[model samples]
Target: MKIILILVLFNLQSGSEVITAEFDDARACDLAALRTFQGVTAEPDMRPLDPAEGASAIEGTVIAHDSDGAEIGMYSCNPSRSDRREG
Candidate 1:
């Protein structure tokens, strides 16, 4: 039982590898594909980008996973519509 518990802990600690691909001018449809790929059902978490803090003109979304692991979600960003200027 101790060995089994150790193996389980090791598996949870060693996260799976993730491959990323960037798409230029990506559409809303692209997000659907990502949802399918990750098997995520809950609505993604969205955060606004503030240019005053030296952040780019982009908004970020957190797509969560249904499984228990070190990584809870995938973070993606899209262009922000805020008119705030950036340095």
Candidate 2:
């Protein structure tokens, strides 16, 4: 019974350490850097379209990210074009 208790305590402590290490690896994301990587150069126009109804629209391109920081795909609003890569 003593040996079993020791093993249980060891497992619990090891599990807690693993959880703490995972939290330590977490980092805050930089919004500006992420936008720049996605090809969003500047803020989009948000002016109202109609006088009676208030609406806003933005036209730009979007690039998808892959595992190795490579652009996996892209989509454009102005030309209505979309390009995706197949694994």
Candidate 3:
């Protein structure tokens, strides 16, 4: 069995932010990431998880670019823990 792990990175003023999540498949993960990105960008008070926290979050490939073509954020999905069976 395979599991989808999504990792999202956000470039912030203070520092880079990272978000990690798990889904059943790539499509689901990407869709969720897109919605989350829109919501986070729309809300000022919403802050992304710190790098350390993101690392802990058991984790697509969508990248957000600026007008100048600078990558501001990214979403990556990959397989994780295929060998570990769920109890």
Candidate 4:
């Protein structure tokens, strides 16, 4: 029982391999196929985002250009989007 529990915990925590999933630009959702030994896992997608908005809630990222982008107040993009994504 302890071994089984440990294995489950390990998989859940270390899991980063997103299955053949896709983030939909149309609805701003993801059709994720999670890992499941017994069956084909199909998780629900996220809600859509407002295209008009600068940053997105799901990723909190924006298409930042050095010229058009503003870091003072309106736009504040990090050095890398990956850095912001982790936060």
> Which numbered prediction scores highest in lDDT against the true structure?
3
Candidate 3 at 68: error in angstroms? Answer: 6.7
Residue 40 of model 4: what lDDT? 19
Model 4 poorest ten-residue lDDT run: 1-10
* Quality of model 3 by C-alpha lDDT: 0.57
Q: Rate the local accuracy (lDDT) of all candidates.
A: 0.37, 0.26, 0.57, 0.22
Clashes of each: 0, 0, 4, 0
The parts of candidate 3 lying over 4 Å away from their true place are 40-60, 66-70, 84-87
Please say which candidate is ahead in lDDT: 1 or 3.
3
RMSD in angstroms, all models? 14.3, 23.8, 8.6, 18.1
Q: Would you estimate the TM-scores of all the predictions?
A: 0.33, 0.21, 0.53, 0.17
The residue-by-residue lDDT of candidate 1 on 1-87, one tens digit each, is 000000000124566434343344445434643554455434433222234665563244343444442334444434333433679
Off by over 4 Å in 1: 1-14, 28-33, 36-59, 67-71, 78-87
> For residues 1-87, could you state the per-residue lDDT of candidate 2 as single tens digits?
000000000123344111111111112112322343344223322222232356433333333344454333332222111223446
Over 4 Å off in model 2, which ranges?
1-59, 78-87
* Candidate 4 backbone collisions, by pair: none
TM-score (C-alpha) between model 3 and the true structure: 0.53
Candidate 3 residues 3-85, lDDT tens each?
56454556567787767777777678767766766564542232233455436432324456544545556666677766577
The Cα error of candidate 1 at residue 49, in Å, is 12
How much lDDT does candidate 2 score? 0.26
Top model number, TM-score: 3
